[model samples]
Target chain A: MAAHRKRTKGTVVVDTVGIVGLGLIGGSLARRLAQRGIRVVAWNHRPHPYAQAEADGIFCKSTLAELMTAEPDVLVLCNPLKAMPAILAELKPLLDEHPATTLTDVGSVKGMVRNQVKAAGLADKYVGAHPMAGNELSGWQAADPGLYDDALWAVTVDEPTDYRRFFAVASLITEGVGNRIIVLDDETHDKAAAMISHMPHVVSTALINELTANPDRNVAAALAAGCWRDMTRVALTDPDRTRAMVEEDALNVEVLLRRMASRLTDMADQLHAEQDQGSIVRGGSLKGDAAAHIRKFFAAGDPFRRYKAQTSSAGDFPARELEIPEAGWQQTLLFSARRGEAITSFIHPHQAVIQIRPAI
Target chain B: MAAHRKRTKGTVVVDTVGIVGLGLIGGSLARRLAQRGIRVVAWNHRPHPYAQAEADGIFCKSTLAELMTAEPDVLVLCNPLKAMPAILAELKPLLDEHPATTLTDVGSVKGMVRNQVKAAGLADKYVGAHPMAGNELSGWQAADPGLYDDALWAVTVDEPTDYRRFFAVASLITEGVGNRIIVLDDETHDKAAAMISHMPHVVSTALINELTANPDRNVAAALAAGCWRDMTRVALTDPDRTRAMVEEDALNVEVLLRRMASRLTDMADQLHAEQDQGSIVRGGSLKGDAAAHIRKFFAAGDPFRRYKAQTSSAGDFPARELEIPEAGWQQTLLFSARRGEAITSFIHPHQAVIQIRPAI
Candidate 1:
């Protein structure tokens, strides 16, 4: 809470921050902090990303040693998952030299990263954070300074975390990005993420892959229109990354998929049941029963009738006497007969009845 | 096909046309045809739809008998599935009285309706058609005159179809609405629609329903940007209609769903295999493996790396010669190394990298 603000403020005043991997998040943070007159430096594994970062006037230290020498109050690890461990190892010596400086990571998952950091004996200085924001698009070039505006930044800390260091890190993240911050323990964060982010991707990807593999895909694709495209757009994101996420979180994802599978199986079973019922009604074999069920099911309700009822009120019309025109020998007249009348009807071309009173 | 247009020019003519059911399709057709100097008189089973149609300057007749008295050269049926049979029954007597007139329907399915018409001995006068166009939105109010512009219109006919009647119906349908026409038999048309139109709705709705049902949906919904919203918009369409469409076309829909289930199962199996392999290789579950896999699946090849490779000459920058700065005592240092070569390494706060690289 803001009650610990005073202690963290002093720490932040002494802290200069270093960010590794100047991708979308790291790059955006660098830009925003520099604009706010905060001294921020970044290191990217790729020279071009850093080259572009330097060209964009975001502060970039020529060397990591020089950055460490600047004595940053905090360090933000923004590199990809595969590279983060090596970078962390490389920073161990510097961290031992500057025990006062804190470190945090902006990775999507926290439990694994937190465990690794704890195993490295940097638990007091290291915090794991995730800013729940991103587009399907990636990279520093795609980064916008305003990307984190109004976003939620989840900050995770454990019993080993120094309260002072945690508050200092949380303040910087909230201040730099102007995002609302929520604090959770590492395990809670991972489980929550699996439910929120990880599961949806698996479901979406599976659906897209299924549709793609369908023999009738060409026709379905043409009819895809709005809904189909919207639902599967995420599937078109990095398929490799999606596969990795689902596979890594296989246990949780498997549970979710099982749930989905059950729901689908239930649906299929219900359809089969309905098919049997329809077959009994129509006196047809089970082989053709599904088709009959479908026919009757689709024809059950009038779509227009449903829409009209949903959108309109019966009171919208004024009451009037119902009229039926006389019928000629060659003309077949169509009319709704009232309870008391069985009248002959006649049809006219120009003077057509635009309103008919339903037989009471 | 246009090569024979000269010979068929005067052979086909469409003037006054009767349209039953003034919903989106019927209303749009009336407006478009009116613009093209074709007389269109339409009728709705309900009073308000007719009232609204009349308010929109569409000619609405009170009764089927009145509409038939117009002796329209062609009649267009645009009612819903359940209402179609009864409407057709009422229109039959009128049709028999005027044998010179032709009839066509703009229903979503053809086989069942065509079968019913055949049973009623009205095959000679009816040509089934479906326009592949719609928004998730529905009704006469949502109708746009340009709804059918440049859309595909599938026209189905059989041995009973009059050649002259077919030409006349096709001409009217293609005149200002669809760009091309696909002529098919009744069974093919229904099967194609089941694959394309109905199946997509089922899949899209299922995805939306799954997302909506998630316990962590609050965060997911909050994090849902343009991509999530765009993907699920169609789920907001009439649920009952979507359910009916899928249930009615259960055979086709079941086939599609089964295909999806298999793909999901394969993905899960692959993920489990990878986990087993990783556990054996690394002695325990690899930390961040899932996140890494997800990211990798979605990762495009890094653009900056591609750019650097493309722009650099062989001798430009020796990989081993590159020096990366180590974080000094207090500063947070971030750096990148690719294939054992240091890219850019720097400390945060004092140095920042900023520039624009065109996305390749």
Candidate 2:
């Protein structure tokens, strides 16, 4: 294994970082980095947030070209996904001129962004990252550095991904932003994201839509309590944003949605069987096969339940060192993530201090 | 319209309430009533909470017979659904002797409880009620009077239900507990509850079941944020409790589950079609019929979104009085609830001050 120390203790490989957008994510990242005394240079599509951002110690640039003049060690594309192609096109020549600046993004979908980067011929310098942070609120006005507190990030990599480039983003999340890192391939990241977020958004939307269609919608709405409110909260957010996220990971979201539908249908069939069984299934108890199936359905998620309980009650999870092999470092880290281990810090370029988290 | 005065202004028909089962729901109701200067008598299957309940000014009884001695104006069965039959059987002779007491309950499912009450030959004294209150936590220790603060209750009545009995339970909610009331029949209450709470619980459980079955579950769990947390929160509660609730309201929950499954399946189909349409559905935007269907699906819940926005932003909702025709008063109040009106107070026996809420 080739062990190369990229930076000193308590510091990241990235010094000056260029942020391509000053939206919620980018603005938060810029503010966080500046608060941590790291040099942050950022440019937004509009100049609205520049004053406040500059006052927060971020060097706000008026143009992407101006942002590149800082010659940052890392450039994070935090602009809207719709602006990716145009921004990537503009940044390609500038990135070529400043060859040392590794390209990364805070996009929710990784594989799509990587493909776009490849199309722009900047794949050689690219790494994909998505921070598991944010709130119902958005835009520059809502951006706060605390949004990333104790956040975990999925740093996506591939066979062609440069180790140095991956390390730059990973170290930025780990040391600079003071967050945890879980290494995964782009497909794994997107599929897992769809399972957790994108697919659930569709399900939440379906719930409100169903309620809206019901003849007794007002009665149901009045009866709604914490369960209904919590379950459908995400559906009330901007549908256009959710639609965009789902479509970006359309294939994965579609697959997961079908799987969810199947799960619901199976439960419905079991319940219907219990209903048809009549007196044999008396007093809130099911009969025969339906009983067993219903029990199994509820019991299936026990592992996740236990995991949540453990993590919520846990404080300062114990950490251990994992040696990264250069020949297959990416797989090694991905395997570690599968075991519910998050990289808290890199002791050196080849050794990561991983913390064990409760897993399903 | 027949007008009869039941109580003077600022006074409820119930001066004392007898609560069976001093658990979460019962304990909270007892505490709230006691705090409001109303006499509260309670009995539990266990005597563990007797001391603390008595300390809170509640008259704790060791047996159901002793509880009936209070001669409460309203007798509320706050025990679990499974215990309903046994509790009702024990109280049958007692309730017969204390015929002046109006019977009600805090069960989540109204029809089932009403059926049990009817089977126990106590239908003449029973008025079904389900409070839109509670949290994930349970038991007497977790119970607090604040749980009833600004809560709305569904008071169920049948064609044969006595108006005075319904008024006793209704006034207990409005005046004694300082909560709002919505009158409904057993079927409407059960159906509306299934739509909002029970069906959503199953969907939430199905979500966790799907996640737990996935190979990349830990990856997805690691990437999970607020959406996953909120959507699956109810599933993390006692599975047996959820199973019991679904089974008790089997027919309604079963119907809603199937509808939800169909909605998810439809969305999945549209997403698949968009995928098949190739470059025509470029950059997070759909094309053709699939596009139109997807747009419609997302837009279908707009009314609910608007209603939520309006309600959350508005304060001190304007209220107006509605005359209650005694001949068909039950139907009149049910219609009021369907129109999103909650009874804040009964100005007279035949009139209700209903507060208008945003309707879906």
Candidate 3:
């Protein structure tokens, strides 16, 4: 690709950009950049994705060497965490030969990769970036060309970084792919990611695990609706990645897990206390402190209430009748009111039933 | 409105059905029904939805009485929980004067309302039904029209219920609303709803409440994405109805809550114990036991994983990097593996440094 490019002083104008690993991010970038008149030279480790990319008219190279031989002004790394080190190691010598060229990587975690590059002593020439966008589907076929539009591209620069080369890469990313650039130090980035991204994943995975592990899950699954579906949607995420995330960020995840555990324990203790105090009456009513606690729990901006209302309002169904077979016929009475009408006295459980002759 | 058409037995074929409460379910149902050449007579408690419904060609009824006087062969109940009891009571006497009429309601919990109807001696005329479809949105304008298509409509029939009327209502709902009917007894229906529908709501609500109530919620919220959003989508549910559902089905909801509480506690203990044991070694690798447990939790068919993948794939940027501090370097390492990538044993906590290197 260097053969097709002309270098003037320190500035390299890249006509064709080569992208390795044509997955969701890579494919999307290629499609978008190619549409913007920049030729995209792409390579996928998997032959299927490579064929698919070639068929989509995305410039495809058969091998890493072939990709490098294309001599593009820039090389984009869009591989997995495991493959990133190997790919970087392989490209280091080639990059050394072409001192005029620049390179960037799109990975979710930067600290480790940065260390890897630094260990390999390729820090000045390599920049680490992450585009904050994506979906569940993977592979080049699922890649849309317009994926990076208006997205934040975080570009991390170290103390030894070449300012000219950093700006050159950042400008291309912002102009060709991203909306803006967020320059952060490595430590702040990891902590923020742990709090915002990693911790949430652990929490979500834990919740899903809780639901599936329930002994009464059969019944729970039966009543599962959009709420359950939405809530546990991430539970089906790839187990390996999830496992790796939890393993890698065990400290922050442990903190989150502790908080969740404390809250759950408190809730459980309250429930048990209510049970011990005989607060749960047979007629689906909570009495005394139990009632107050239940009310407080519900009143605390719980989203379940809104979901119930939406689910309830979807169709015209009568309120469910609680069957008290043990308690036989009593004097039952029914008093009906109109919507928006004035309310009279509240009907007590006893008043619900009244002995009376038919209205004549 | 009654003057427009005579109340002949077969003359009142409902070409246009008016829906009063056009929330998520109502709106979706209306849209679907309207697509089938039926005119939707819609009336909301609020007047703001009228213009939007009219723009969508859903003929808005100015008043409830006007809708009642219009005498459509079928009247659907899409109002709120407390409102249903009153509306049904008022409409009971009016319907007694009009022959050849049928009515249905869509309420989440059925036992309480069924008891009210049975006490009022209106069971022979009214058929209670619940359609298992909904989202976090409300109001007539929020209606999607196609919501009920292919969903299951639970039809509750008891001793006092008229089979002929039940079948008629079921047929109309199945053909018109686009959902199949699942016949269930009132007791089974309530229990099933409690386990499946009500319990999920409580779990989701608890999660949201837990997240919101966190002292570090600002951090949690920033880190929140597809997993957190999907898990708490139900948190947008109507508060009042949620309060009632919890109160009325306190027994079942409590049971599920207890289960969730225990599960969460166990996970917390596991994570905490691992931390205490220093199971996360120098390389940031989780011990065999902890890793196995984490893997099992993730592989347990939770939907969160799937949702994460979808969210990660949908937007422009599939992969982005956040630099964590050296202190929190483990967080990035754990979550480094993206979806669709295999797990490899290359993470080195000691080698991991929080440095911003130049882009590749």
Candidate 4:
């Protein structure tokens, strides 16, 4: 495996993609890439998904050994978080045989795999990517070819990413498979994943359980408002998949839950203190800094929403047909040219907004 | 006020409606009722909403006293929660004189107003109503004429309600305005409101605040999914209005928040213990009752969502233009018959579902 790293190329674009674990993410990506006329071979331990993919025109490599025999240019380990290291070990023989094969994974957390790969001295051959796109639904049955459409794919790599091969393979999946890309390191990716998806997922499930467990379950259901529905939508997620995510990200999730509990405790205490002081308390009795803090806290989510609207809204500029005003190359350049992600112009039309996304 | 409750009437139907507040709920109801050829007069402290409603062809009353001078058949207290009792006190003298007027209100909580009115011995003169419909937006600018259409209007009354007058006024607002009706007592209504609206509102704001306060806000925002948007929509609410709702429902909200926090704590503990046990956990590590509880917890919300689809979804039975099959009378009877809130049939579709809701 160590010797394999030395046999590198200038720029490598994977012709064949070998994906292990044909769940929603893997199956969906396989379908998308295969639709784009790329050769995609997948290996799943279960015969059902493998047979299903084969029937769906996906090349079926019966096992990891068979996948290695095909000499795929890129190998994606899409197995559960706990299973990646073992899969990497199984693929090591293949890596030693074909040094040109770039290794990557589509896992929620990156630190685990990155650390394992680095420790195994296979760092140069590995890249980690996560597509920030999913629904509460799960498995091959729920897979959609356009799942990654306009989705954000974060590629986690070392500071000096392997521009020649490793990064190139990840970019093929990120860009060629049709997604916007952002680059960061493993720790940042894990922390961000914890905040954005993993922990929020737990909170959502807990919120659901709490409300549903209440004595007023029937009443709560009857008055289920839009916000409540949206907040708890993820609660309807497939139990098996949610279990995987929770178990894998348990530590990060616990940290997050504790953090949230701490915040809630402080809030409850503040309200209680206000009540005790006869301060004519409301729901939350903060007249100054605490109120400001809460406001600021809520305001923080706005940027992300705005950013999503800019990137993922219908007829996103890149996909739209703008009548190039005959003399409009100037205006087109004004909008199409990356003015450092001017999100406002896109949302507010008076600003001559250009619907543009910065390059990865 | 006590003498006002003794006014005898063979039958009562409010031909004219006087609404005391002209914000979203009040204005929307006023416009809807007025559109149905019913006379409506609205009075608000703010001249803007008042002027706007008047200009919109709604009869404008200068004040509650002026509204009483008009000799309206029914009066709706559409004022804020904190102000409803005082307004009731202000209108007491008028209530004593205008014995024929049936008084009702559209407030989230029923206990406060109902109790205060009962204390004044004006119980028979008052009925409490809350329409389970709203958006994050507030004020007259956001009001829609069809806001009540396809909504659930919960009408709260005493155990021995004045069916002739009370039901007539409530029926006018619910059935005539094209909404489904549910009847409950003041305490029951308050408890249910806490379970559904108030606490969920706080949780939404808190969830937004928690996720935003994370150091990974930019990333979290970038990865935010539809659930995140729906969950946090309430975060964009007007501060003053939210403050009012929270203050008004503080005690109930505290109870709900504590319950949610309790469930969250148990979850965190279980996950922590599971991680400690290293039982090869997945999303959540509960193998016995803990696991069953979670599954049941998530399952409880499904019935509500299904019930909402049955009652609130478009063309929801009543709102639909069902071409009555000459032979479809039986199914229609099975559906439209007052069989006591057969929520199961709409959800399961297999049940012979009596469309019955219990009469007060």
Top TM-score model: 2
Local accuracy of candidate 3 as per-residue lDDT tens digits, A24-135? 9988888888776677898888767766666666778778777777787778888876676677778888878877667778876667668777766688777777776677
TM-scores for chain B, in order? 0.70, 0.96, 0.63, 0.76
Q: What lDDT does the true structure give each of the candidates?
A: 0.58, 0.89, 0.57, 0.63
Report the number of the highest-lDDT candidate: 2
* lDDT tens digits by residue: candidate 2, A211-324: 999999999999999999999999999998888888789899988888888888888888888777663224445558887888898899999999999999999899889998
Residue B201, candidate 2: alpha-carbon lDDT:
93
TM-score of chain A of 4: 0.73
Tell me the lDDT of model 1 at B181: 47
True contacts kept of 1: 0.20
Model 4 off-target regions past 4 Å? A1-12, A44-58, A80-90, A113-124, A139-141, A158-165, A277-360, B1-12, B46-57, B82-86, B115-124, B159-165, B281-360
On the 0 to 100 scale, the lDDT of residue A154 in model 4 is 65
Per-residue lDDT of A1-360 in model 4, one digit per residue for the tens? 223122222222567888888888888988888887778889887868776787677888777998887888888887776666677777777788888888888887787778777766678788787887777666888878889886766666674445445445544653347555445667666776666666666667766666556665555555556666777666665645665666566677677777767666655555555445554423234565544444454355454445444655546444222332333333342233223221211111112222345221
Model 4, residue B71: distance off in Å is 2.5
How high a TM-score does candidate 3 get? 0.60
Badly placed stretches (over 4 Å) of model 1 are A1-15, A50-52, A55-57, A186-188, A279-360, B1-12, B49-57, B157-166, B184-197, B207-215, B225-227, B279-360
TM-scores, all models, native as reference: 0.71, 0.96, 0.60, 0.76
- Model 1 residue A337 distance off true place after TM-score fit, in angstroms: 62
lDDT of 2 by residue, B1-360 (tens): 113133336546788889998888899989989988999999999999999999999999999899889899998888888878888898999989988999899999988888888899999999999999998888999889999988999999999988888888888888778889999999999999999999999999999998899999999999999999999999999998898888888889888888988998899888888778763323445568887888888889999999999999999888889999979998999999999999988886788888998887
